[model samples]
Target: MYRTSAMKQYQTVNIQAQTSGASPHRLIQMLMEGGLSRLAQARGAMERGQIALKGELIGKAIGIVGGLRDGLDLEKGGELATNLDGLYEYMVNRLMQANLKNDAAALDEVSDLLRTVKSGWDGISQ
Candidate 1:
């Protein structure tokens, strides 16, 4: 348990360090990736019947999706940003549903959406 805690702490610091030096574009990409990862973990927790863990993971994922939505500069980004904001909002709603019902399908749906968005984010030449 101590070893696991130590490893988690190390990873947290590493991610923090990476974020500290990252550009805004990279930060968005990181958030998308984190959301996807959390969704996957939430699914695993559901499968294991770890209800609380699943809820916690899904909540974290929803927060990440919210962050993505909040980061959108709708004023300057125009139609595309508006569309993405809507999509992110949808993702957050679905995440909440997944948490409430322990629904793996909902998790899959959000994972797919996030992946599509992240793919587009990745394609942009930053």
Candidate 2:
């Protein structure tokens, strides 16, 4: 039998919390965990250059790690774009998809992106 949405959500969260560090594995783990707010935080990290994809700074991990690459690198927090307008927009879309469809895959995708961003901005404060 297929897992229920609540069950899926629980699984996703568990994965995120359990996984630490900036490994790509942890990023994917977080997506499955479920949390738009966390995702947004990650995005902010990426835009600021606190996270690296393929060893280079990436503003949008979504374009790169959709399904490819072994993993990503996460730095501490730092300043992102003066205006985080676009990043927020995409995050909302991802959050909706995860909530409405109960799509763990989609959540996983967005979560990775967020983690990359979060890693980049690990040290910086809002």
Candidate 3:
């Protein structure tokens, strides 16, 4: 399960699970209501390799629907596993960068991505 805590600067959200699991569709709905456009912009950056983790370029971004429904264990679809991993890492990097830069806009982009993924998971559950 994911938990959220209020912080002085920003809210701290943590996903706790033995393995990474897919999110629910309602997450997508929430994202659409929040800022889907920003998510698209961030996605563009990802495609352009603008987003990096540990200074390494992200090569791909996978959008597999409910791929991780079983658990954190990865179930590859096509050739997207590696790219999805990179994208996930890149988002983590973006989150850190946004926090350090005090960029609310950047953080919003990441939030939207999370919501989309969660929504995909929700679809899987159904």
Whole-structure CA lDDT of model 1 = 0.79
Ranking by TM-score: 1, 3, 2
Per-residue lDDT of 38-123 in model 3, one digit per residue for the tens?
A: 44554456445564431221111112112221123346443455554555555656655653454556556666676766566456
Off by over 4 Å in 2: 1-83, 123-126
Better of 1 and 3 by lDDT: 1
Candidate 2 lDDT over residue span 1-126, tens digit each: 112433444444445546643354454444423344444544454445444321121222232222222122222222333123345446546645544444446546766665666565553443
Looking at model 3, residue 63 earns an lDDT score of 21
Better of 2 and 3 by lDDT: 2
Q: What is the per-residue lDDT of model 1 for residues 1-126, given as tens digits with 9 covering 90 to 100?
A: 323432443355347748688766777777777878888999999999999999878877777777677667999999999999899878877877888877899999999989998998999997
Give residue 116's error in model 1 in angstroms.
Answer: 0.4
Worst 10 residues of 2 by lDDT: 54-63
Q: What clash pairs does model 1 have? A: none
Prediction-by-prediction clash tally: 0, 16, 4
| Ranking of models by lDDT | 1, 2, 3
Cα-based TM-score, every candidate: 0.85, 0.34, 0.40
Clashes of 2: 16
